[model samples]
Target: MRVVVLGGAGFLGSHLCGTLLAAGDEVVCIDNLSTGRRTNTTPFLGRPGFEFVHADIAAGPLCVRGAVDAVANLASPASPPDYHRMPLETLAAGSRGTEHALQLAAQHGARFLLASTSEVYGDPDVHPQPEDYWGNVNSVGPRSVYDEAKRYAEAVTMAYRRQFGDDVGIVRIFNTYGPGMRPEDGRVVTSFITQALNGDPLTIYGDGSQTRSFCYVDDLVRGLVAMLTSTETGPLNLGNPVEWTVLELARIVLEVTGSTSPLEFHPLPQDDPTRRRPDIGRARRLLGWQPEISAHEGLRRTVEWFRARPAEVAAAAPSVAGPQVEPRPGARIPSPRRSAPVLS
Candidate 1:
């Protein structure tokens, strides 16, 4: 199958591209690189059956030359720090970008998949949020820019599906982390891993009791592909159901990196969810998907990836001026290592 993946140069997007190519599917990857790194997609450059296009779906229409059998709209500033920094861009990507991708899919009669987020459930009243639960989001809050935009995107997708009979599916992705994640992306996993590796203190907010469910990138990508190819038209929840507190996750990071970094406490950001977990019953029943990577193993692999390229990770670390540090001239380039699957 020929597939078009927007935001294909991002952490999760790059993984999706690799997985699809490995399955012998033709892939057209498009990204604007606002938050995505070109280096993430470097492995696919000039590879057979893979094409990369530098374009922002929010800016204009995505014009591909050949037939597109599927369209996966993964284009958005996903991380809290990223969306917070680029609020307008995040909103546009969810609104305009989604509209553009939906239109393209409709034109080609292709299957459309929207990579929505668990943030839409925002500080939920319901624990282990199911797809049917209406979220308790604050529309005027600082995080609303991302949360509301995704809610809007889901609404628009449903509208298109109902009005034009488009073959569209929506997946609410939870916290996903793995090797391709930028060291300074500001997500909890990357932050903890990088800090542990650098021997810096792991920063925890709100007494470190908030909880989250993390799915390994590869497992999430498999779920994505399954949803794309399935007949279920759903706003399916996709994530590991195993839950861990912030303090527990921090401990795991330290253990994985074998670091003695002290834990530092801070005030929680506004509108931050105290607990987040997904009820992925639909995905399990319909797509037969469940994450296989345990947190310990996933963090071990992530630490190894960072340790192998310390200079690159440090250079990308966030600061007041931005990611501007220069890497050492002769730092060794580490060969890519595949993440090991968890054994039963």
Candidate 2:
């Protein structure tokens, strides 16, 4: 099979590309590098049956040669810090990027997959959010750039499926972290891991009571592949069901890294979800899939990854010389994990 993956150099997208390639599929990876790092594709640069294209899916039509059996639209500024910095670009990705990917799939009679997010269920009123839940998003909020973009993407995906009978699927991904995550991406896992390694305070927003469910990258990628090959047209939820509070997760990070970094408190960002967990019944029922990696095991592996790259983690760490100043909206830390061996 020939697969086209947008945002292919990103943390999750890079893993997807590697998985598809290992499964004996020809892969064409596309990324704009606005948020994605080129080094993420370094391992596959000279490998057979893999190609990387530097282009923005939202800018205009994508130019490609030959046939495509599947198109996975994973493009966009996915992290909170990223989307917050590139608001217009994020909006464009969900709108124009999604449209172009759908068109490409439709033209080639290929299966289409939209990599939506759990953010669509923003600050949910429903516990363990199911796909059927209408989200409680504030369209004008600071996080709306990503939340609403995904919501729009899902809407357009369903529209194409209903109106044109497009072979389309939408997977709402939750918090997934592993080797490829950038240390300074401002995600809870990455922040905790990097800070603990650097012997810095683990910054906990609010009283750290907010909750989230994290899936290992490998497990999440397997679920993605299952959705790509399945016949279900769904807004399926794909995430580990194990739930943990922000404080609990921080403590776990401390344990995993064996760091004595003290915990520091800060105000929670506006519109940040106080609770999040996925009811992945649809994915389990339709695709016969559930996460196999336990949180403790996953965190152990992740800490090992960061520990092996001490310089990268230190370089990515925010300056803490004197007064505490918030990082600029979109500032990014270089991720060297791209050069690391592919996770099995």
Candidate 3:
């Protein structure tokens, strides 16, 4: 099988590509090199079955050398820092880019898997969000660019599947973290880990009571593959059921990193959610999938990855356009002016 992984060079996308290749499938990864670094995909450059294309999926279908068997559309900016920084591009990627992937999948008669997010749930009135919930989202909020874009992407995907009889699947990913995660990435785990490692004050926004469930990247990838192969075509939720408050997560990070840094509390940014966790009943019943990595184990792996990366790469990894602050862990980059609450 030849698989096209949009955003294949990104932190999660790169790992997904590696997994597919290891499973004896030919992989063609397409990335815009905006958020994804070429060095990230260097590992697969010379492989007989791997190919990389430097193009944004929103721009159009890929010009690969061969036919594709499946399309994993993981092309959008997932992190708060990335989406807030590249809002327009993020919106385009989720909406137009997703549609583009569906078209390509339809044209090639391939299975399509859309990597949706739990942000679709917004600041929910319900605890442990289930797939049946329609979600309470602020469409005009600053984070609307990414949130609404994904909602629209899911809408378009279902339209393609129902209207055109396309074979498509939607996986609503949750707060996932693991080895390939960029150290400076704005996700809480990375932020806390980096700060603790650097002996800097860990910033805790909004009194640190907001809760989120963290899923390890490997487990998330496995679930994605399972969904791809399963017969259920749905907007299925994929995340760990374990839940922890922001302050609790901070304490865990301090313990994991053995840091002496104090915790600093700050005002929560606009559209920040109060709580989020996944209900995996559907995933369990349909795909026999549940997250296997605990938050402790996953954070340990992520911290190790951050500790191993070259200083130059770590400094340059987040975004060149970001603030000029030192690239240390826990270094507080400015939040987006009109930020929406991110899934993580």
Best by TM-score: 2
Q: In candidate 3, what residue range of length 10 has the lowest lDDT sum?
A: 335-344
lDDT of 3 at 180: 74
Clashing pairs in 3: 143-340, 194-329, 195-329, 195-330
lDDT of 3 by residue, 1-344 (tens): 88888899888899898888889988888887777778888888899899877677776554444587888999988888877767778888898788888987887888999999999999899988999898989998767888999999999999998899989999999998887767777778877777777777788887998999999999999998898877679889999999999999999888877889898887787788899999999999999999887788888887778777647333533222332223445545333232111110
Ranking by lDDT: 2, 1, 3
Candidate 3 clashes: the total is: 4
What's the number of clashes in each of the models? 0, 0, 4
Residue 207 in model 1: shift from native, Å? 0.5
lDDT of 1 by residue, 1-344 (tens): 99999999999899999999999998988888988999988898898988888777877665676688999999999988787677777888899889988988887899999999999899999999999999999898878889999999999999999999999999999999999888888888988888787778888877989999999888999999999999788899999899999999999888878889999887788788998999999999999999999988887887888889889766655322221124536644433223211111
**Which sections of candidate 3 miss by over 4 Å?**
63-65, 310-344
What's each prediction's TM-score? 0.92, 0.92, 0.90
> What global local distance difference test value does model 1 have?
0.86
Clashing pairs in 1: none
